[model samples]
Target chain A: MKRLIFCLAVLVLALAARPAPLFAQAGGPLRLEITEGVIEPMPIAVAPFLSGTANAGELAARISAVVVADLAGSGLFRAIPAEAQIAQVTSFDAPVRFADWKAINAQALVTGTVERTGADRVAVSFRLFDVFAGAPLGDGMRFEASEASWRRLAHKVADTVYQRLTGEPGYFDSRIAFVSETGPKNARRKRLALMDQDGANLRYLTGDMSIVLAPRFSPDGRQILYTSYESGLPRAYLLDLETLGQRPIDNQAGVATFAPRFSPDGLQVVYSLERGGNTDIHITSLVTGQTQRLTETPAIETAPDFSPDGRQIVFESDRSGTQQIYVMPAAGGPAQRISAGQGRYGTPVWSPRGDRIAFTKQQAGRFHIGVMRTDGTGERLLTASFLDEGPSWAPNGRLLIFTRVSQGEAGAPSLYTVDVTGRNLRAIATPDFASDPTWSPLLP
Target chain B: MPIRRSILTVAMLGLLAACGQNAPYGNTPPPGFGGGVPTDAVDVSVFGAGVTDTVLFPVDTWELTDAATATLTAQAAWFTRNPQATAVIEGHADERGTREYNIGLSARRANSVVEFLVLNGVAPSRLTTIPYGKDRPLEICSDEACYARNRRAVTVVAGSVDLGS
Candidate 1:
């Protein structure tokens, strides 16, 4: 028996010593996991693509520049300037000089080539390399689009590069709809404005004839639901982005409806309706024009937002004697309060990843922009100031854009974006004071 | 001559007292634009000018405070004097809370005012509530004083009396 036991022990030790066959380490490239929280931006070098034709050279350079900007704006990767590059990528299929990148301490290298496919058409092919591993990070890919869509093609390349490194979707191709404010502080003129996620290609969807508020995009990014005070009463209006056409909702004559948001499926809109001195959340189906009251409580219930899966809704309610965040079934049921902190939590928006909820909190006379787990744990305040309200999550769910107001009369609310980890707080440049920003999903 | 003048002055004073007693009050509609009161017109009286139109509330609470109740009580008296008048109660909040949540809070504040006025004999049908949240601010300052004024409910009267001013 002793001899048998010794043999079994030896077998077990040998099995442990050998690595698991299923967990075999592939020999290709070194990849880093881009987890939540702060870390030094990985240094990357994106070489200007070698154009297949002489006329495509300028277009190639422009595309490369856009890719650099998109990656830098993410606060995840720092692109080394062309002046810092030790080696030039003259050919698409040629091998990368790992030693040259190593000399510059670049962890990642990107090389691409562009070719003109037709009049107003182009094809962009790129590859990402792990400088240390001396191998391609993933399979190379090609994107084709019209020359007018060059910016979009560049955004696509950046998205793929970001996904290759971070293992997450990129929000570089998204858009935002916000209320643009100008004039004096009191009688400010506000119009609905839309722009690319990087604050380019700005377009005014509505004139300054009326006050617009809380413009939220549909899931497909083709339409927006906003509240306008055109009839001298706050009412919800649906605007089509492609046509720039709009119409008021069929709310009852005496009732005021506002704070509109699109349902996950974009088949209905959930908004607040004030009637007979009481405010309640009402869902109106776009197909049937049928309005259903979600909450009938005397306490005000507004700001209803849907979960990513459309199975649940997260909204704010004052039924508990104070403003608190709550989640309920999408079909309307008993709501569970998710915010337990002492502060007044409101404007609770569920993250696109369905992992967290972002909100604005007011406590002790100060306001803060914060995020919490879906179940109300792991609360983190990303920003605190005299005023920071109305947080809208980026399409990637990794960042939030909110309205931040300065102190005093001159302190108008401006658009600002912050990373989920409380770092990279930056202001989004707008021509005027902006507020109630809603980010669109990745463009088609 | 002194006795005749005293008699004429007493007669004039009696006539004035009778006119005051006969003025339209209670459930009777004022004799102006017939019985139909235009709902679209904005009447700034009952709660405007000499009368207090707005009652302020504390942060995050919709319950009427002592000061708010006092102002609304006077407002209720004005409503009593003008029974035919209808009102649109506009509720507002300061820039402290989320825009959507503040809408709810403002709705509650306006509802509280409506309830108090109803309990003080204002007809329920004569009031409509609209909550503007933090979208509309009476004072643009960011201090507590401005915020205090911002968190308010204003009763704008509407009736056949042509009280546009």
Candidate 2:
């Protein structure tokens, strides 16, 4: 008996001496596990879009509302309601009176002038001012857009102002490609709806063709990747904007696919596949259906995002006994836990800048928006409120925009934004409840 | 305010336990002072048994108030005494704004708490964060009071914060 026990103990010790497997060491050295959020929101103001007569098509009146919507939707600025706009500068050509704006306690101010250069051409020029410092921080390029391009022009203006204030590129001038809902949750009218970031200029790309979720924009803002319940099963689909083109990403079946995002170069799509009650992140080429599994985690893993270099992937998994962010090589290897905290974390989105990852965290029955360094250090929670999730980073990587839904009395879904510093809280303009927002990169 | 006071009282006791001094869990300060609210002890009658859609937030902004700050302060002190404790502070907002922006706003709220603890001498290495942009809820009520409560950061004990003392 003593001889047998000695042999068993020796065997156990040998097993324990082996190195940890490769799949367990993939996430880079930096990891940010956030444990707190800011108590106050920084204040900012977005001016109405400037307009003038001889307009391309109701030119002057429409742009202001669009600007308001863009700024508000970001949740980083407060659109000084036309009612409380301390002073209205008539045109971009006119000098701005910083005192008037500052008097209303506006920390930041925007002003613009619109000029009709020709029958089909209009130029819009805007300037952003720091109310606290009473100086012009930046000015936007003149947009000589046609009447039909008026809305886009306003977005560009807002984008410029946003970039100036937030010190990052603006996503306001971009578009939100989401599924427009017109029916009940069980049986919904699912169409690929493309609208301005402010919920204006709404158009349908996939005219009620299928049920879709997790719409992601192509890096250049030309196409989208979404999960469709078409063909009698859920699969990934890509839609082209210019021609309203549609193509099946892959013939995934038996197990459905969901939560898809494109690489920075648009060469690949990363998504989740439900196989026998377990989900894992998978990657496939845009040209060919050939796939490479990025996460071997047996537990559910969804919402995979690629690092800017496309060399690594950050995803959420329950391999650690709870849902948390994990990282592995883009080719799929050992996974490292980026989030090692208690509450469940999911919906991980890699920032465009590659310095951080944004994700949703649930703890003690509440959820929040948070970011952490690539290694999981410096974990900081940026926002907290009822039902805040689905973080989409602006092109600049300095600002984060996400959705907020109110339940019970003031229950409604709306968009909000904040800087990485946790300042500049504002709302985006919307006519109804909206969620699942994706920010587009700056247009050419 | 009185309810918040009650919450503060409980939070203080909880924070005290999480503090580096109070050894509720064990001797090696739990990771992050990552002390979390014991959901197992939540009363069904006061805050409701199951999760509801309702929440509460302060007026004009999403910042936690003085009372709220006091509660967090206690949490910070507890973090000082514990070494292994880790936590994820989650921020939230009411349903008044758009969803995308609220995610960032709520994240800022959570980050502030992390910053507070760090400023109070809590090690920055022990914290981790992730933001949930309006995907989860705590209450079913949508009134101002409910919204006030909803717009907050939940402390999540990650790793070995619960030492099973």
Candidate 3:
């Protein structure tokens, strides 16, 4: 009996001496899947970066604030206010007090260190931790860039942290192209404006010499396709971002073309062309300067958008006596009407994931932003307003940015964003009235 | 309501002028004469002389109405009178549809006017169509009357107008 007991004890000790199974440890990494969609933002705490250099303290605070703002603005992560922090982090290398964070209901924590490397260069290093799991989510990453690019560095940090937590890529580093409006409603001066996703770095791509509308970015973010009324006729123009050079899109002498979007491959553009009292969808190859009619109907057909695979096209048409969504072959074929709702539907944009389509719906004298499945089922209205139109999806297909026009003479159009789940509706800050926002793909 | 309001204003002004000229004092309008003003009291000159500059259309349609055809016929005659001038037909839509789709609809509406003018013996070269969609509106109000005023095609006679703004 004694010998058997001794053997059993030795076996137990041997098993205990070995490391716990990969996921059987007291605290292992936690993976959060945003598949079903998260309505409540996970509470996160961002500790001020540790810095010991000339003006490093101020810069560090600013960097951390930006990081917090980026994550909070996403609607997937909520930053716990500094007053809610239970413990302060003074050293980047210090072990995280998971217990303290857990007490404040912080599901995630971020700690970082910032240092001045050169006269005008700084380095930011950060690590994200899952408080409940008591383990670092991903390896720490350090980004070095000029001081002038501090905001971008901050966005990069937030993006990395977001990707680690959400299991999806981040769009914090992306840009938006929109129409900036000023003056009164009757004589509004609208200019094409470009800015960061967070509304930073406001730049006007066109002066107020003429009205511009519907600015769309190429997949590579190197060019923009927009409609200009410079010639007193709405025509699409392709503007190269690098040179600010633009040329008129190819069209027949009497045909007016507008509502342009780049194909997934960025080698072609799909737009609407109006000729002889009839409007239809057309696809134009950017390389060969060739154009093909995609839709040929007496009813108005416009707002053509290509599927991510560039195999199909979805657009808005009024063939049935009311506006509705339609899908057709990319090369042109008989279109299948998708939207079956009572009211008018338009601005059908295929989601990046290709599983859903977002659109602007006008029903019973109310405007709404809604989404539906590819085959037109599972319709969901995400927002309602006096005037809400022009939905542009984030690259991840998780969020949408659109325009909302207020009511009355003081009513002006502005940009607003909402998650695909129809939560976190917030107005995007702009210098003035902004509309027709389109999101660029993730930065290279 | 907006159309009625404009007509009433014009009628009231006409009544005041008649009183000033004949009675030289405030006087009640004669029973039949007060409401005798024609429903079409809206003077064609309000839309610009010789050219009925504005032709309205029904919602989400580019089909020419009988009234619209009448207006376009008058416009064609005006273009015939003014040979040196070129006509730019500006098509507009009410702010009830999507911007891009409205652009398409406006184009169709403008083209309809162009076709009607051509049918009426107006040279195609003398008329060019421009689809402003809902970007420019004759009325910015959201009511039905305002929307009706907005869904229109206006023919502007430009005498060497520089359209390249």
Best by TM-score: 3
For residue B137, model 3's alpha carbon misses the true position, in angstroms, by 1.3
| Candidate models: Cα lDDT each | 0.81, 0.63, 0.82
Q: Model 3, A95-126: lDDT tens per residue?
A: 99899999998888999988899989999999
Tens digits of lDDT, candidate 2, A1-444: 999999999988876665432111133221111112322223455556555545533566577677776766565555667778768776666767878887787766766667788777777777777675666775456777886787888888877766665555677666666555543322234566677765678776765544455688898889888866554334677888797677877665455566788988998999876543345678889977798776665565778888999899888766666667889888888888889677878778888888988888777656788888899888888888767878888777867778776555445556787777666666766554555667777667
Worst 10 residues of 2 chain A by lDDT: A29-38
Q: Which has the higher lDDT value, candidate number 2 or candidate number 3?
A: 3
Instruction: For model 1, report DockQ.
Output: 0.25
Query: What TM-score is obtained for chain B in each of the predicted models?
Result: 0.69, 0.61, 0.66
Query: B1-165 in candidate 2: lDDT tens per residue?
Result: 556545545664565555532222211223344445553331212212232212224632445567666766766665665555566555556554433334444545666666777888878778644333333434436565665556766665533332221
Off by over 4 Å in 3: A1-28, A35-37, B1-51, B160-165
Candidate 2 local lDDT, residue A403: 71
The lDDT, on a scale of 0 to 1, for candidate 3 is 0.82
Best by lDDT: 3
Give the distance in Å from residue A157's predicted Cα in candidate 1 to where it truly belongs: 0.9
Pairs that clash in candidate 3? none
TM-score (C-alpha) between model 1 and the true structure: 0.84
